[model samples]
Target: MIIKTPRLKKGGAKNVYLENVSHAVTRPAMESRRVQMYLLMLLADTAVLLGSFVLAGGVYRDQWPNEFAMAMGWAFLPIFLVIAVYQRCYSIRALDEVRYAIGQAGIALVLSAMLCTVMIFYAKAATEFSRVMLSLALVAAFAGMALVRVVMHLVLRRIYGPSVSSVLVVMDGGPKVDIRGAQIVHAEDFDISGVQSSPNSLDRIGRLMRGMDRVVVSCAVDQRTKWANVMRGAGVRGEVVSTALQELGAIALEREGGQSFLVVSTGPLALHARIFKRGMDLAITVPAVLVLSPLLLLVALLIKLEDGGPVFFVQQRMGANNCLFDMLKFRSMRVEKLDSKGARSTSRDDDRITRIGRFIRKTSIDELPQLLNVLRSEMSIVGPRPHALGSLAGEKLFWEVDADYWQRHALKPGLTGLAQVRGYRGATETENHLKDRLEADLEYIRNWSILRDIKIIFATARVLVHPNAY
Candidate 1:
């Protein structure tokens, strides 16, 4: 018998969804120059600082900067650059707006001051340097650096209104925009990038731009997770590609240079960095379980009394290395279903949730049992939320998904994070909503810190008390 394999199209079903897609709004043309500006600012600021010291010495007749000062000068710029990268002070997205520029510059300056102050004190160079000169150099460095952002905003506004649009391509949608800021405002204001939906609009706009500017997908109306990914991926070869919201927020646009696309996905967390995280889990779990045992027992009793069922609910959870682990939680549901792959988000009045379960979930007392997993090295205190792998129905259901959605999980899952505290906690978030949450989580992980974890823990507590927790 001859068996024939059925023919499959090269594009696959997914291609049909993408091929018809087009880019409408243009991305900011300022990326190249802006990068140069950042480098120049950092370097120039250091040069000015050293120069100011030499000038101060000349003016005060102390003989041009000593050998010790010269050595410090050599160390200063590189050290500041490291600090800037760590703080993401060089990131264009970090400079979201004029206000954000000031804020970031303030942070960078403070960091510089700390380093400089420490160096001066240690090197016994504090008395030798002019305080006012150092301060002036810092002020000049901050202002000069901030000027790049200011110019970028102004040039971009002149080009496309606000944010960093050097060109605009509006799609056809309900109520065509008649006036920029009036009844029918331009779609760019909302950070919506693509043509409102007008076919050939992008082509016409592309001709206008000569491919000089960035290409953005400005979703005029709400964008489904699928479309947002398509449009964001459609940026011109060299131009920036981002969502309207990102363009509007104008603070941390995703990076792509050579082989490096800065945004990370969640899948690799289970694969690449398992050992490093397992060590952290051992450290945290050992101490946490030791400290919170009494609270855990009390919570278990409360759960048992509130609902006449087993105190602990063991469900198969997607754990580190993508292995199946019987994740334990104080049973909050009256009756648990084995195939709850799809059941997520304990609602305000989920019938299955017992009265005490409601309180426990709101207060996050139910998650106390996960400390056992932490002790066992199954989870971390601050990472992405562990979702049932099969049940999640793709990230769109639980995250504000985009083309690079999976990149959010490069690290192990966390019990609480940047998402949970920023008013994104609780449930019923659509695809975009979850993606938004994941975005925050991604931001947290990419810029992880001990301080940030502390902040998240504090915010989680505050969210528990707020009336909106339900």
Candidate 2:
């Protein structure tokens, strides 16, 4: 027998996918300049604020800023900058619109004035500072900031062509859609960076996204999942035109040529929002664990006393990005060498469930240990529920049942989720059950807010008594 080995192509499949596109535009220089622009804008805004303070002092007291007045005005600088950052005023996206800049500046002005009032009251300095001058300063701050922004915007427009955002448009099968500031790039063009998706047509759009402002995905409804997963992984600002986005309500609708399309942008959570969400998680989870310590101890004792087995169960569960982490639960089933994949879905009145397990599972008290997981950052307080690797619906694995199943893992797994609150919890037997759960998860991801998370948490309390949980 003659031994023969095939020679491997150089650069591998990735290089092959990337080789077609030669004119790959990278945005590092533009991005660096944009940062410089943000800094320059901040400096200009500071000058306007100081000028407003001086004007207010002169108007109110017939003098330029005194030492105390200057001190007060300078003190407002850090506060103003903090509020501006929290409001994302310096963000490139914020600069995209004049209204956005004015709104953010107004908010910062109001907040700064409110903080000044509170500080003066608390420090017993209200009698020292001129209230009328302070009021004028507040008004002037807003007016001055807005004026500065308008001037800077006009100047920048003249200098740099308005900094209009560009997007890469990827079309699957649809009438030619014209998007402003978008370049249509074929998936077959590999001279530019492209994402090789299917065997027939590679998803070259990924390669073209380097310096692009955003990506507009217009594909068949069935192919939405594929595009969504790709964009989610890319961590790029993207918008998908889908009828499903109409669920996001009137705000997401864009009308073109009397035709309405639901446009959903996959921008990452704002820094302040992310901080607020994480703060909420820590706020609730920390105190709940502390206050419920006795109850947790009681549950642990019950699990231990039932069959002299381990009180806590640690099992691997899929978390964000399909990463596995050891998830904790109060031991609710009979201690045995069971499959880790949760191959055997727990049905109502299952024999594997111990006496204590039956009670805990029904009330969802068994999930309380996951609060530690929340504290550890392995999970979130409100997100899609994680599942075991072997978790299945009927005879097939969960991912095998639906292509979009892994998308749920894009967010951290939670102790409870939108699916549970919507009555889609417990053993998923049919494909429809899984689909319902997936839909709820996707909806949660799309519409996540601090208020929505609070609502889900409140809704989960009602679901704890749900009869289907067991």
RMSD of each: 14.6, 16.1
The estimated TM-scores of all candidates read 0.46, 0.51
Candidate 2 Cα misplacement greater than 4 A, ranges: 1-122, 125-270, 337-339
Off by over 4 Å in 1: 1-36, 43-78, 82-290, 301-310, 319-323, 333-358, 375-377, 387-412, 417-419, 422-458, 466-470
Weakest lDDT window of 10 consecutive positions for candidate 1: 176-185
Q: What tens digits encode model 1's per-residue C-alpha lDDT throughout 360-418? A: 77677787888877776666777767765443323444333455555555565677778
Error of 2 at 20 (Å): 46
Instruction: Report model 2's TM-score to 2 decimal places.
Output: 0.51
Top of the candidates by lDDT: 2
Q: lDDT of all predictions, in order shown?
A: 0.56, 0.75
Writing each residue's lDDT as its tens digit, candidate 2 over 170-233 gives 6665435566445565433332222344532333444446666677777777767777777766
